[model samples]
Target: MSSPEHDHVATDLLAALAMGDDPAELGLDADARDHLASCPSCTDEVAALRETLELIAAGGGTTLTPPPPSVWEAVKAEIDRPAGAPAAAPAPVTSLASRRRGVPTWLATVAATVALAAGVGLGAWVVQPDEKDDATPQAQVLGEAPLASLDAAAEDRGAAVVRRADDHLVLHVEASDLGGPDGTREVWLINVDGKRMVSLGLLPVGEAGDFDFPERLLDQGYRIVDISFEPDDGNPVHSGTSLARGEIA
Candidate 1:
């Protein structure tokens, strides 16, 4: 059995790997590699995280595009604005594209991947008009899974769970081109036996959302991440029409 120290190292290694860091460059010693080779849970976690990262990176093309100067100027203006002021009207399409370009492609992709994996929006880092002090909490990534399309028509999906400082379990989900016109998409946590299940919440189409749940549910083995299409029938059960599914490591 691995000691607590080794397990901590393993977790750090997995997080680094998820961020697209080179394991060797991260100073993964021989002992750490050996532990990873022997621990099935750790191995599976690493595989899932790597797959998710690859999917995110693949979605972004190889070339890097720069944003226009106006985009930076607007962002700077917003940041420089007095606290408690109302946010200006939404920027134009060209400005939005410029804002996206302003961020380094790799950095933006990594942030989006992490945020999506953590059930947060890509705008987490964006400065808002809020005047008060804002602090970001540190979270420990527990595990992840790649959502597989149930059918050829389904789009790509991924999910990860993180343990917040307060010990809450937060699920981060990402979906692409997976929305349906019939109804909104809902998230579910199901057991391996497929008998017990719990609804986390609804997910925005083609975007990411972080849903929090009591950690005890996970302790009871509800680790399957599922997305389903639910119509406006006012029902509170699984739709039986699974769009994407993945098993958490």
Candidate 2:
């Protein structure tokens, strides 16, 4: 009964459900109700939302609290960096070509495909079956991870490797390299994928912090944690050069 026209309305209604609004309180009227009753697609969604709502209730309710003041300050500082003020990326390995040149394309493709399949299989084995699959909420919740203090280990150096003690590859930035008239700003972040970098917050010019990342991003592909110096250009991407750099190793 509801065509794509009802999409936005349905989504808003579902979001309210997550906040514990009863369906009757949604004021959906007749068409939305007819659609929900007849459409397996919409019914399934409602079920999922109800489950999520229950989880939120038992999970301390839900709130979209803004990040702390320090995070905003760091964000504003990073946005204020200048152009052409990036540190250089590490030099390419001269021997890399020698190792990769003679490899056949077909063979390389096969190897890559196999590697991807293995990784997927490994991940499926780890996801919990259902929210209620475990007797304790802890079993359903992801474990907290701590990356090593590579952030503080190499502060104020010309160039140093910033490796996470944790096996998952992530970043540790240095503000000393990203000098500015206002001062310096550095951050360690995990690649939340191609969209954006999850800032570990501004790194202390000389101190270290927890900088934890969500476990969901643990297996995504990433390497080459970059550090850039802000020159007041108002740019977001790297400045075509890196001020400080390190490999995943």
Task: Locate the minimum summed-lDDT window of 10 residues in model 2.
Answer: 119-128
- For model 1, residues 52-124, the per-residue Cα lDDT tens digits are 4565567533322323454445555655667777546521111112212223454444433332233222222
Local distance difference test, candidate 1: 0.62
lDDT of all the models against the reference? 0.62, 0.39
Clashing pairs in 1: 119-172, 119-210
Report the number of the highest-lDDT candidate: 1
Query: In candidate 1, residue 113 scores what lDDT?
Result: 38
Candidate no. 2 TM-score: 0.25
Candidate 1 residue spans exceeding 4 A from truth: 1-137, 152-155, 179-181
Summarize candidate 2's per-residue lDDT along 1-249 as a digit string, tens digits: 325334322333434443455545566556555655676645554565455445545653343233445444443443454655532221111111122332334333322222222221111112223344444432222222222323455444333333334333233332233443453344433353545454444556563333445444445533334444444566654444334444343
Q: At residue 8, what lDDT does model 1 achieve? A: 25
Error of 2 at 142 (Å): 16
